[model samples]
Target: MQVRDATATKSVRQGWTGRTRVALVVALVALLTASMPASGVYADQSGGDNNSGQNALNAQQRAVLYNIARDTWKFYSADVDPNTHLPLDNIGPNGKRGTYTSAANVGVYLWAVVAAHDLGLISREGARAEIAFTLIEVAKLARDHGFLHQWYDTTSGHVIRNPGDIDCATETTPTFDNCYFISNVDNGWYASGLIVVRSAMPELRGLVNTLLNPMDFGLFYDSRPQTACNVNPAVTGNQPTGQMFGGYYVGLPVEQGSNWQHYYHNGALYSDPRISAYIGMGLHQMPGDVWWRSWRTLPPKQCPTDPDFSWQGQWPVGGYWQVYKDPQSGKRFNVWEGHYTYPGSDLTFIPTFAGGMFEALMANLVVPETTWGTKSFGLADRRAAQVQVKYTTEQLKYPVWGMSPSSTPDDTGGYGGYGVEGLRFPYFGSGADASHPNLGLSQCHGCATEDVVTPHASFIALDVLPQRAYTNIQALRRLYPDLYRPDGGFYDAVNPTTGGVGHRDLVLDQSMIMAALDNALNQRKLQRHFAADPASAAAHRYLSFEKLSIADTGNGDNSGGDSTGNNNG
Candidate 1:
């Protein structure tokens, strides 16, 4: 197995003969694709809107997706903390045990377990026991107002706050004392998994509800953007730019003696953390217009020039201004459906903070964003996947296409923030003001020798770009025979050039693969589970009734006439 040692900082294991590589590629292709017919849905690429595209995956394709989920579930089924019953964050061929876990990992593990049963990998009783045990132990874990802390020791179910075992993005002091942050994004995933569990296994809804009842997504929401973030209504006529603050810092307030909420906000509406905001709005804990408050690419009026706008973004996007009226409040909001044009191409898309797959597509796992928001997020979701493919194959010329944040392709258990950085533009927002021009790890155009392929990323895009995703998965396994493990579908990450593999199975990644497969094969079982909830119904109109600038929906602003702003159409 070959791996990338970026910067030549460390030696990556490499031992592959040219002849051996050719033989493996030839042999593996036959085994994986031998059954598929050369003709039909596999060849056409129109985003799968036809009978052969999204309508149906051939029996062979369905079997392969199901089997992959079955294999991926094996990781979750076995990697349990005996005392806590919570899944470990990650494990290698025999990666050390008693490792730490996060709220996202624990939640995704629950989804994996339920999905395994839904796919018949486990019996109903077996799945119920697994989820019940994990929930019971989860009740014992420490929390702030029902939102789980970012990290917890798996074995003892203890909060790993002070000097937390993992890197704290908000690390402030040398002691890592500011490590205790309750993540809105992590809990969003946790709550998403709980919705799946409760909906799929009604017998256990009581236990799931006990844990969910106390959770108030509203605690993290701000109804007044003017009051919370000091945005003036004078500059922008407003319904209210009420937003969801990113997450909470447990300690470390502005004042030394008293406790105050220390928070960060996810300005990008497409980020994975939006999952928490979705859940909150679905349950009516948060206002529906908060949905409009998030920027499609930051409002054109205030972007780039506004002092409050984040310069660390793919700003100056092309889009249209539209208004969405909240039925609950009868207030109309001005919104920007801004999208980035793929450099040197006519296509436009909505890019995430890091231009990663899960960051853009993961929330779609439980919530059917593409199905309801067909004109808005759905179109963007398709563009998101397509641009990734075009950049990886057409531009970067990599043999495969799954670029996302995954383990660095080595045995060190290091993490890599890989993505189709050049999907549009290289990150230019690294400049302090405008002159210093620092290139942070934002976007990169044609940056080769540093790309990574994650199999879960392909699965994440399965709903949007099925055929390409399927083809890419086969390409990965064929080109690198070692990429697929015995019980796991594929290793976490791989270097396309060397076929180097990252052999760790992250619970979050594996669970994503399971949820994707479950959706593809079982007619969106998890999505149906979420849709069955009355709460999801409350959030339905917000998704279904809007027209984004990305495509023609015929009747623009479908939520009645635009009462507030000029139709920028």
Candidate 2:
């Protein structure tokens, strides 16, 4: 299928003049460091709470993760299309490759290959060959402003129209030429992987840069701050929007300032799409204030007509409105310092789109948010992990912990979103109300259910909850041995009630397992590789320096964040 790119591809450096690039850098630094107080400051000191947390894996834990990585790599080793080098989205019980792949699937596969080599599962030469083939085909695939379309035919590497996609073609009929939309989060993951591949295999740098450099992250950036907080049209007037959009339609007029869908602002800071903002800032495609634009929870505003008060999140919302100023334009933003609390507890944390483990931790696989924002994101990351553990094992009385989106655990083939229902916001497409306390096990109403305990969630938690993550994996094997597939790695999802498993291997899920192991086993090798990118340097301060208002509500204490360290044994 022939497709024209929205923007002509350029070299890694793009054609921006040196002066223009320097001005972007100046603007980014100003946003990160030059914030002046309007009413009260955001308590923006530096570092994260529990920054020193996360203990090293022990001998037994290392053996466990090593074996898991070795087994998980087998899925990619066999499931990839040899002619195209692109991985199929999944392999079902029939042991046949699935039809489609996404920017997220390919994105994680890039790092999976690097992780295999880093873990000694594959040689450097083998890893480079695999990555090179993938990039060569990717360069041939159609893209929007250097960003690949969301879905592509896995076998042929052509953009396909999927009706089931969250964002798909505007055309009613098949128009493979330029059918699909470009998703900010999907492309962010893809770009993040290229960043890792570029660093891990230096020999593949030129080919990788050919694909990575030209894709400007700024294309998806919605730089304007929103006029209101919650879903209130009247109060907000809904005009001045901010942050990144959910996605973009390459067919629609843009790159020329036609703001039709900029209103689809992904307001939450902890959502998966935050990766786009990170990459955009690093590339100087967006300003640093973009970080300040996303909501921890769209502050508990006076949207009285809306149900569940301002936001349909957990009750007794806790936070303050902290104002920040733009140094260049002198514009002020009333950033919400708000957060959600676990019912009957003071465990305060920022919520994700659906309270899924991957949503909270997927970006953590590459970006060192935990280390960079120890007081801010770092503290919230650790608390979120611990909350999942406590909620599942202690409250729900499940033998194993770790809740995330995965395939339905039933024998019939299916897929759906699963997460800690209490850990999300109903206002943000999550069925996260206190009334229903279902873990990722049984299907619930309203919230996108098919809630099954995905092992990948525990795997992703290796960075934050070192001890619990390791022990939980052991318990999973002990309680539900069928979940582990020694030959093809662990299956995707499991039913904690029954010994049922999803009996499938997904590229994205398996890749998360590989990446977490890569960092956990190799002393954060994947994160370090991505950190070396020039974009990472540009956004380091934004990640590192911040003091969030997420505090313990049990005793009404406001120590800023939980400083218990990285829950290591």
- What TM-score against the true fold does each predicted structure earn? 0.79, 0.79
> Taking the tens digit of each residue's C-alpha lDDT, what string does model 1 give over 474-515?
888889988896566788988898888878888889888988
Poorest lDDT segment (10 consecutive residues) of candidate 2: 3-12
Candidate 1 deviates by what RMSD?
13.4
- Could you tell me the TM-score of candidate 1? 0.79
Question: Could you give candidate 2's per-residue lDDT for residues 1-569 as a string of tens digits?
Answer: 11211111111123554345344534533442244322111122223332133455667768877888877777765667766768888888876568688898889999898888788876554565556657777888878678888688876677776623333334554332336467888899998998887667655556666677688877676654344444434423343245677777765633334445332567677867888888888777877667776677655554454333333444445678887665424567677777666655556677665667887888888887766766677667777777777666655667887888888886566888877655332333244444642222111224544247988998888777777777778888888888887776788888887778888888899999999998888777788777766657544666555567775322211123332322311
In each prediction, how many residue pairs overlap at the backbone (N, C-alpha, C within less than 3 A)?
A: 1, 12
- Top-lDDT candidate index: 2
Q: List the residue pairs that clash in candidate 1.
A: 2-500
